[model samples]
Target chain A: MSPEAQEFLHTFVSESFYYWASVFMLLIHAGFLAYEGGASRVKNVLATMVKNLITLASVGLAFFFFGWWVYNAFPLFPMAGPILGPWTNPEASEAIKAAMPYVEGSYPWSSALGPNNADHMTGVFFFAFALFAMTTASIMSGALIERVKIGAYVFLSIILGGFTWLVAAAWGWNYFGWLFAKMGYHDFGCSGILHATAAFFTLGVLLNLGPRVGKYDPQGKPRQIMPHNLPLTMVGLLLIFIGFYAFLAACVIFLPGYEGETTIYGTPVTLASIGVSTTLALAAGLVGAYISAKADPFYTISGGLAGIISAAGGMDIYHPAVVMLIAFVGAFLMPKVAMFVERMGVDDAVGAIAVHGWCGVFGAVVVGVAAGGFPQGEGIPAINLGTQILGVVLFAGLLGFLPGYGCSWVMKRFDLLRVSPEEEVAGLDLADLGVPGYPEYATYEYVNEQLPVAQSSGSTKYAE
Target chain B: MQFSPLLAIFNPSPFQTHSEFLEVEGPFYTFAHQPGMIAFLLILCALGSIYFVYASFFIKGEQAGLKSPLALSLLLALGLGAVAERVYQQTLRQSDRPTSAVTRGVQMRSPQAPSPRLKPLALLGLVGGSAAASRRRRSSASRQRRIR
Candidate 1:
């Protein structure tokens, strides 16, 4: 094993981890499909499922191509240099091609692998971000579950997941992003970029699409749209929680490396910090949401997630006690805010507006004050509540909510947003699927065996 | 407006060289732009008061248990916020960060950066379009009732 083989091996393993994370994140999409399917009316389940599947296929492919490139390119393309600047950047581009990693003039993509100087984690790193992009799109899938057309929603998913979320990530989340470099804006994970942006975007779409036909009466009052299967929905959220952990874990650089002072404690970076804060936040969120909800299982689970969303921007540095405490606030706010949004006539079917969108804004904004006066890092500007709010505005309002609203307005104008009224009444699934998933669920044998008994009982009871 | 003033409050600064974007010096540091948990609590208290005062005008008939869907959604929102933040922190999520010590011009690279040509979108449009291309699920009873 030569030293060169070691570097190549590292790149392979890291890239593999990156791709596999997507495999794990896939469970989240699957869970959302099931969860949304269950939440929908019986007539609309399959249609909802199709919406989920479409988001996955479309968002994945979109990100794989230019989606990933844009993230890489935007970080410093014009700022860093020129056309091939991103491609040739000594820092961020492909290390193998530049360095001639293995044999000179003979490599995978080209004759030489780029520069050999980098630690070799860029591809895996981008893949991780791409996965986040997919989740952002997937978030919209859940909110617009019952009404959005598969085609229309799929188109929307590509825009939200592939383009919108990436732009936010570049602006707020990326270290080299102008936002991070200049604004001192910080989002440890996507409080704004992923969650908030998706939430607002969903709100935008819902505004134009309107609720499922009967969601509101002619009187403008909202109705109770129960999940067709509460237990299944619960199960779906549990899967989301489990997979969400992966989504969160993928946001930080976790691979082992040596920073001076050798000892883990002394090293500026440690997975332990993330681990501790995450735990504290989860516990706090769980308790806070559960306490408020009186133990409603659905809210309990979703609140737990919201807690994390609201505090995600600086989870990496908050004290454990503070982390738990803030998480409680996160949990406390998520529901209250969402309910308020709903009351305002903005229907977010799965609370996407509240959980991801509003909460994301809150979380991003929270960072400005939470770490106030602290050095944002050299050359990264000073912290300001106003700036943080602006970041939230840039991401949630401008890039996310406003644009989302604008898109919906346009979509509505073009008649490309949702199904017609008749279809909504019949149920999108029934119109889409040739047959309903359930026919009272009587097995062929059971129906034969039980039908006669039922008939006999009816006759006897009536006769008596 | 200055971006970091507010942002700094929430995600204030830490020590890092121009080169080391990926390093964190300590446990999660609370920022200065916004109130810490204590201030947030005060705000919540204010909000609670407002909520209570608003409800004071409501008749007794309006008070209800946790069964309403709106109530349930509110509850879910809170929980999901916590969970999303927690999940992000707990996972070993990372992006590429060049080391501070590595002299100028030394950074990692990736395999052919993902290309954004028409191919990827075509695939998504094709497969995802199938979702649109899919057969609409129908209910037998509705179909039968219509036929009758």
Candidate 2:
């Protein structure tokens, strides 16, 4: 091919790849919708679906306005001084300069954030990151479903997605992030910055929201709250499994250099490694979860997720055996963690906390041990047990759990954290939306009667 | 590239009593063959096994003593995170090269693009409107029930 043709082709391919990555990330949301809907009771399915849809819309717009800017701008934020400066390379220095959120080249007001003759990839890149931000919000959404107020949900979603998650990305995921530059923090696939952040955020919300009605008996023995449609939930998980291909691919930083694709931290890796580690981890997780939970399908699918998360931090560097073994351990531990949390009275409707939170922390630890002493970035220290552990604790405890807890606590104080008990027993659909997801399958009286405390007598009278 | 763990299964010197497994290829066997990684995996396994056994057999459910320990552990984690972040900031400051936190934050807020403020307003409106409608519906339903 001619030189001009080759350049055009490269641009076309790069833009196309990013666009597709964003599209595939949408599948993650579809999966969450299906996953949450199936997990919800027949009455709350529509409500659950609405929450998922709103998160995409809210987080999408918010990300466009401020989220992307936050990621670029805050890499060395909440700290003083130039990071990795004294740069002789013009390109490198310019790239760093443009990262500031309010800068002319990168932020919302900048033409760079939009489609321009000079740039074709910026918008596409933003789309992918926006989707990631939305995904983090959706993870928290699932755990708080069926009980949370819409106002509270939307408020928290924006805080987590558009603000907190972006901030965490700035601190940890950014190449120039102080965590990477100074502390040698490494999270190849956002296991800590994204998944664990969301997981801990969800955990905090669950603590304040309280358990679903009849989740436990008077004796405190947990009762089973099975998914309304296990098949749908499984299918949703399958969609997520498919979407993960794009999610994992998006983590690669493809630049014009001797090495084409590298991690955000500038670490070179083969796509083959990611593929091998992810699949083996998934397989191991499935087996571990299946065996641990005595072959329950819900836990089995959850195990698959745990598997992916368990090895996510080291996917680029880990051997397949390491991936499998890590995932297996994570999968096995997740169910026990879930049961333990349930006993503690934090009723996570799905195993969101176990699969995302515990597994995320586990995955980062895998990287610390397995890939410890490996260089994470230029001029930074090697990955180590202390750094990895510190990242997990900070992301999961301070950045993740603290904000989630504080937000939900305020919402709870104002009675915005949960639906009224009457709404809970009658179902969110009848109470909130005045419409049932399935009128044919609706059994209002039976649902109300099963409640430990009957707040409403024969849920009746509705407005058009 | 066609990747496989065949080396793990088909070692050339199978007859040797003390053959090194470090020569294997593929993503799985290559890393597992490393001594440090092997030691890491073994330690993790041992710890995992003990924890699993203890959790399953001894700590059944609703133990009152668990709360204090969990709280204490979480507090320690928070303190450690705070310290680490502070240390990281210190390192960034003491370095010969410096990154400007103030300029970055300022530049981040003042994008060169024509970013309209209407989008955020619209988002707030959508969420606020839906919430109000739901609140009205619930109050109206309750009133209707009371009248009946």
Candidate 3:
């Protein structure tokens, strides 16, 4: 093949690969829909699914216009002269040049941002990041399911997906990020940046949004809010298990000339290592979570996700056995953390805090312990416990919590955050969407009337 | 990296269809080729395939345990892996070069760079779009309250 033709072919295949990754990642949204739908009361199922779907639309568009730019622009904070400079200077590494905002074609109007012959990877890369951004929004969506106002939650999704998470990505996940350079922060698969950030954001929103009605009693004790559809929830989790490969795949760079592919931070990594580590983590996590939860299927599957998140930070470097062990620890500890948070009066509907937030922190911290001497970026300091801990605090507490709380607080002030008590009792679907999830079953009054008086109580309705 | 006889199929070196594999040295290759690692990995793969064949031919419900799901999962995984391998062979043909060099001057040729000043405008647009939706919701909420 001619040199030009070879280049073109390379571009086409590379773009196609990233695009496929983005498409596969959409399954995660489908999983979230079923997971949230099954977890919620029947009256609120459609509303939950709609909220999750709307996030894809709103966040997808918003990220295209701005989130992509944020990632490119903010990699350098106090010093950013290199941005928009010529790419051939050869002074700093390619990783640094790639991180410069709009310099390497991240501007919305840049030809590299779209389908241009001159650029093959830009569109697909942006699409992948856009999907990642949407995921951050979706994570928060599940935790505040029943009572959050649709508009308010959607607004938060726009900000979290389009702005906050992208900023965190620029700071840590980007190759030329100051944090990587100065603090030696390392997160290969974005445990802290994506999972932890989204998880903590959900926690913050839950704190401000408050628990769903009937979630707790006046005695400060928590109640078990069983999922309305366990089968759907389990199947949804299975889909997420399938979709997570795409999420991790997007975290890698598949460039033409690189031997083993590099990470977003330009560290040498391989899809093989990712595949092996994630699978081991998932298996170990399932077993661990099952054991810890006394074989509760929901937490057992969630433990699989927790294991992936926990091992994600170190997967790029960890041995398969080590990955499994780390994941096992994370999964085993996950439910206990959820219990502690519940005891603290925070009713996280889906255990997002423990699964994503705490596990993400655990993942980051353990990477520090396990891979302390690993290099973060070219010429930068190696990974250390201090830097990893700092990254956790920064991602989960500072960026995740503060923006989440402040945004929801502002919405609360405007009375835009929560549905009123009346709306909560009537069900969000009936109150907001004007339809019930199961219209046929909506008329179970006659069936209830025929039941024995003891079994006909409101609390026993779902038991049947 | 300690050898896990079970996971040797994930070793990247054996599947180097692309020329770049020869040029670039992966970090894991340093420890991956420990004396008996390759033979151990091969044995594991052979054992696994043999077990799979046996399970498909003979195992029944109670005795089958997790064999069916495991087999199905492996088939799907191998299909996806094939797709990935095809893409890698087709695309990753060139030597290592920075992405900056490849897309240089393209942005300049297209249009003016987006100013940092425009970021807030995009955010404002999101807020405005969400605000319109909220306004309708708030109006409906008030109507519900009055009726109650």
Candidate 4:
């Protein structure tokens, strides 16, 4: 093929690959909606589902306006004058500068944001990254279900999805990012950047938001708050498992002239490797959860996600057996972690902190242990253990926890974080949205009767 | 006068002439070059600020003192006004140029190029009009309750 023909083919294939990956990633949102909706009591289901929808819209718009620009502009942030300033690989930095050329391409007003004949990749690539942003926001949403004020949640979502995670990506995930260039950080599957960051962010919000009203007894002992529909939650997890494949696929790059695929770090990898490891990780996770959590359906399904996340950091590097072993151990430890978190007086409704946060950290550590001394890229330092630990602390504590905690703390001070106690007991859908998720059911009538007369005034109309 | 970063945000497009802008190739070429884009963004910022205030305060029934929202809205409006004034000046300058320059600018844009004023105006109408309509509904409902 001619050079031009090869370039065209590459652009077309790359565009189609990301576009399809984005389309399939929609299933992750669908899964989150189903999962959170089923986890909430009947009254809060619509409220739970609406938050997921808002996550998609808010993050999408935010990413379009500024999030993409942040990723492009801040890869070597705090060093303004020369692109090759301190702690950066000059050659790799130059290559990335040529590839991104953010000033010309990434601004909201840039022609690349529109239908420019000169650019074919920006829009689809932006969509894929935006979906990742939405996924991060959705991961936080499940942990705050039932009692969080919608407006407060939306504010936090934009901060996390649009701003914070992008900052983390600019630091750790980019080819010439300071973390990779200076510390040889590698997280091919975004285990630290996306999962751990969002999970830790959720932990911050949960600390301020507190447990649901009835989550604990007067004795301070935790009680079981059964999901409205366990089966629906399980199905949601299954869809998420499917969507995760696309998520992993988006992390790989298909260079135009190169014969094989590469991880985001430009290291050689294969789709077959990703597929085999992911499948085995899922099976191992399920078995581990089954044995550890005593066949609890919720924990078992959750283990599947924990499994992928625990092994995600090394998906491009780890052998199938290693992946399986790591995933199994992560899943086995997830319930214990959740119990530990709960013992510390934090109530995570969906084990999000455990599944995403704990497993994400676990995955990153495993990679450091397993792939230590591996070459990252030209002019970048080799991967090592200390940097991986630093990534966890940076991603989880500085980037994730501080912003999450500070923002929620402010919201809490203003009484904007959680719904009023009255509203929480009356159900968020009835109190806030003024519609029940299941108005046709007799349970609606029962709930209406259960409410005090003052709280029931406007809600009775729903029954009528 | 010292340059204000806030002022820079309102004047996003740097190109001064249609000919100068057309030298750049891409889709949405005209859209980005047009001064109206600045007004559109300023208006978006204004509306977003207003909505955030409304959602955070009014919807939650918290007493938000009028000052914060009022000041923010005023600042955003000033930004929009500046953009509009600049666009008006640019339009006047462009009218003095040769007709061929104008024709070339038009030709450079896609066939579906939107009128420069349409987006900001439409967005203003949608958000402001919806808020007014909802307030009217609430008032009528309260009036009915008093009557009953």
How does residue B121 of candidate 4 score in lDDT? 52
Off by over 4 Å in 4: A1-6, A79-100, A444-464, B1-148
- Alpha carbon deviation, residue A440, candidate 1 (Å): 4.9
Off by over 4 Å in 1: A1-13, A76-123, A254-268, A440-464, B1-148
Q: Which scores better on DockQ, 2 or 4?
A: 2
Give me the displacement of residue A383 in model 4, in angstroms. Answer: 1.4
lDDT of each candidate versus the true structure: 0.60, 0.71, 0.71, 0.74
Please provide, for model 2 over A1-464, each residue's C-alpha lDDT reduced to its tens digit, 9 standing for 90 to 100.
99877777777777787788789988989999999999999879999989888998889888887787777766776562343222323245554555542333446777877658677777787888998999999999888888898888999998899988887888888877777777878798888889999999989888899999999899987787878998999999988887887888888777422335667887666666777777887777886676566466788888888899888887877756567667886786677677667777888988899899989888886576556545444457666557777778878988899999999999899898899988987788878788888865526654444332333444343211
Tens digits of per-residue lDDT for model 4 on A160-225? 999898888888898757787777787989889999999999999999999999999999977878
Name the candidate, 1 or 3, with the larger DockQ value. Answer: 1
TM-score of 2: 0.73
User: Tens digit of lDDT per residue, candidate 3, span A269-337?
Assistant: 788878887788888788656655546667888999999999888777776655765687688667767
Poorest lDDT segment (10 consecutive residues) of candidate 3 chain B:
B1-10
Candidate 2, B28-93: lDDT as tens digits: 232443455456555654554464456455432231112233543454366457445544543443
DockQ of each: 0.15, 0.04, 0.02, 0.01
> What lDDT is reached at residue A251 by model 3?
82
Model 3 ranges off by over 4 Å: A79-104, A442-464, B1-148
Docking class of 2: incorrect
